[model samples]
Target: MSSSMSVNPLWLFKVFPFLRWWPMVNGTATRADLLAGLTGAIIVLPQGVAFATIAGLPPEYGLYTAMVPAIIAALFGSSWHLVSGPTTAISIVVFGALSPFAEPGSAHYITLALTLTLLTGLFQFTMGIARLGTVVNFISHTVVIGFTAGAAILIASSQIKNFFGLSLPRGATFAQTMWAFFQQFDHINLHVMSVGLVTLLTGILVKRYTPRIPYMIAAMLVGSIYALILNQSLGDAVTGIRLLGALPSHLPPLSLPELDPHALSQIAPSALAVAMLGLTEAVSIARAVAVRAEQRIDGNQEFVGQGLSNMVGSFFSAYASSGSFNRSGLNYEAGARTPLAAVFASLFLGIILLLVAPLAAYLPIASMAAILFLVAYGLIDFHHIFAIIKASKRETAVLLVTFFSTLLVELEFAIYLGVLLSLIFYLMRTSRPNVISVVPDPRASHRPLVHAPDLPYCPQVQMLRIDGSLFFGAVNHVEQRLLELEQEHPQQKIIIINGRSINFLDIAGGEALVQEAKRRRRQGGDLYLYGIKPAVMEILQRGGFLEEIGPDHVFETRDEVIRHVFSVLDRDICMGCQQRIFHECKALPSPGGKPS
Candidate 1:
């Protein structure tokens, strides 16, 4: 590492896109990339269709999203595991934002969707260029947990109509669904139910018995087979199960999004919200995999990659897209070598979809729903949820608040609430630093064990420990506590602070310490610091507080000052003290200038 730093090769951010990772490429990596890419292509098939429908777009759009955007994102993104495509979270968010603007499954709706996608991409690209990846840092872990749980609920709710073969209206809120379910109890579709049950069971069995085979595909196969058998037996017209129909075999059609000022204005805010959500999801997933892979994720580069991918995807008839957790997890499990895996997956998927798109027309909607239910179930992190609930009251509160708020409030706003709450709670906790007065363990027969700070102090010197960063947020609390210590005990004049735990000190904090030192000196007392760190001392020195605090009063060892300070103590108090805390004081003559 060099002491001086220079700007990285900025041109690499454009050309070849993979130039940043080209140095890591080798022979063993190629094999790993191939396996991961194959797994990703197989897995993305069902997910693409499911996500596109969720976004209120034609099924082809989802496949389109998985093609060009994925390859571009992989080559440009910082992480090897992050596979970009249409995801459940992004799909649901798009549906929520655009459904109110135009009727779903209409030309007007499609136009608005494309416009929104363009705007969202532009916003994300702008944020990336601005290097504002730190924006996600404000969203605490609790918020993420809570938001995911709520999203899980929404996912299950959205698929409930298909799961039970009912005719409840699409896009119903949780409360609305419950009410609608009760009202529509008589309109249950039995053919849809049979296919759904078979699909659900097949998924479960495949997972338990043949874990290597992707359960969603296995379930869809079983469901489709059952539909075919039923169609033949019932003469096709009697059954109610609807199929996806065939997809057009071609490149994602190039098209321009609506350029109207009113159209862009209408969806701009919602687009911004989608952009933030997409970036957060992508970065978070990348970071998680990076930790496990023993790799470092470049957040700024990730932003740029995601932005470019979405922008390119929008023109190719793809809707809003982001990092798919399922694809990324599968990639990691399959031993991905590099970002090339994502590029390959998209390429393979394009070829596979063309061959098998017609087979999807035989697959029932109920089967698709059953598959999505499994997807929804997998999104929830139950073990972590339980741990958070048990570990900390503040974290638990944040989780519950975020989880519930996500359902009732707007998606973007709920994240803000959780972040704000976490910050407020954090500040409240750090404001009060624990100041403890300690002594050497008297009960230890062999060596000195560091004792609790509440132990009685020496008659000659008061020893206290400051256990937190001294900053503006903590100034008043620390000052008040220190002043209270003096007021409570008038006899405790000489003060020694064990400054080992003071990790940081700011200007306001240094000034506060200086002021406190002057007040103590004026009252016929001196303040001393032990084990002063070079870093903390530098702050005091630079701020001119070291002169006021008196450099002579600082000590490296506990016994040095206490031995000399004992000579100046009152003899009556020294003789009366039963606690022989310090060996040095006990070894020396009594304070009255007489031998012990």
Candidate 2:
């Protein structure tokens, strides 16, 4: 083979990720993908329009978003089943961020949205290149559950005016919306409410009974048909039922976001919020589906894929997009074999758009609101929410704080707050490592160290096992505990630390240990360590802490520790003590030069 062929393919895979799965695209796989793509295309028709309504964008923009972004993400991302497009969380966030700056659905609003999408893409791409994918892990799963549930309520509340046919102000707060809703209770349009109720009920029944059918599409069709009947009987003038005018039946046209300094600066903050949320949604959905598809997901690759999709999508008049859990789940269940399924779905969506765009003229705003209500309801993960509440008070607090913050504060700020609280909680736990007193289990064959408070301890020596990293944050707590132990039992001057569980030891920890060793030596006893990991040993050695603590004091085995300490222990105390916790007591001699 040539030297060129002998070269590693890893670099090539980084540049062109689809190459990894291209060889698997056989006739069988293509056929499966085609079917899955068709199913996904059909499903996104109603969802694209509904999600667009939620985002305060023109309905066709939603369909356009699904096309270009989906194709780009599928080609570059590592997951075989993940389908990227507009999602509820991203949509609602876009609306929340931009609505204050410009009127929703206006030319100015669209321009701002495009700029936001471009900025978000840049953030994601930069993070991916910098290999900051692990940063998302800091945003706890509890935070997501809370944020999602809160966003769901926002979605439902946003549609109250349309759902009930009341004239509520745009950008109303949840409380204001509800208050206005009840105030205008007498003026509710019966015809619009009837259409929304019909759609909602139809969706509920169809989803419950007919699992195979796309319930949104079914509900949309039923709702549209029912609205037509009502309008014909009562006439449009009397019914007050509004229709979404016909959409343009064409491809996503070339467009440019305003790149002025003012526009960029204005949108930067919201763009970051969108970028983080989008990446979280995409990477999470990718990993979730990858588990079922038995594929390994590269989170950085996913970030890069999502970044490129939005960056390119911005030029094609597409709004910000991310991984759609519903569409991705459906794609996997429909037997999608490769990323080609997602590519096909996007292509089919474009084709489907050309055919169905004009049909949207008949789509009632009330019915769209009803569809969004269902979308909102679906976003709440009741199982995880209940589990978090039942399992842990700490997690429950995080969840509730995030959930309430999402409603009361700026949507993006809520995410930041949740992440901050999660980090604080994590730091609180790690900063206080478990400094447990342990004894050798007599019943176990290997006599492993166990935390048995009932076991009698030696008076001359104390043994402690630290169960967490000894970093800067935790060194103080560990040092304080050691100081307390010395104060409580001054006679037990010699100390042994089981360092096996200490995965990390920083400069501060090493310095603390050196001080501890010096203090112990002044009291006529020395600090010793056993089961110290090689990495930790290297740190201690590099810092000259091992010299201060005495190189001979560190042992590798429990037996070695016992024998060395027994030889140096106060044999006079052992002569009278009844507690012979260690088996070494059986053979060792007392201070009088006789076996006790």
Best by TM-score: 2
Local error of candidate 2 at residue 249 (angstroms)? 0.4
Task: Put down candidate 1 lDDT per residue, 123-235, tens digits, no spaces.
Answer: 88888788898887666777777877877777777777876778787666777887898888778778888888999999999999999998989999999999889988995
TM-score, every prediction: 0.87, 0.97
Q: How much is 177 displaced in model 2, in angstroms?
A: 1.6
Instruction: Encode model 2's per-residue lDDT on 1-596: one tens digit a residue.
Output: 99967957998899899999999999999999999999999999888888888889999989989999999999998899999888899998999999999999999999888889999999998999888888888888999899999999999999988988889989987788888888999999888999999999999999999988889999989999999998999899999999988999999999899999987988798899899999988888888888888889899998999999999999998999999999999999999999999999999999988888899899899999999999999999999999999999999999999999999888989988998999999999999999887877877888787888777778888889999999899998999999887887788889889999999999999999889888899989988899999999999999888888889989997789888998998877887776777888877665466785
Count clashing pairs, candidate 2.
0
In order, what is each prediction's RMSD in angstroms? 4.0, 1.7
Which candidate achieves the best lDDT against the true structure? 2
Worst 10 residues of 1 by lDDT: 446-455
* TM-score of structure candidate 2: 0.97
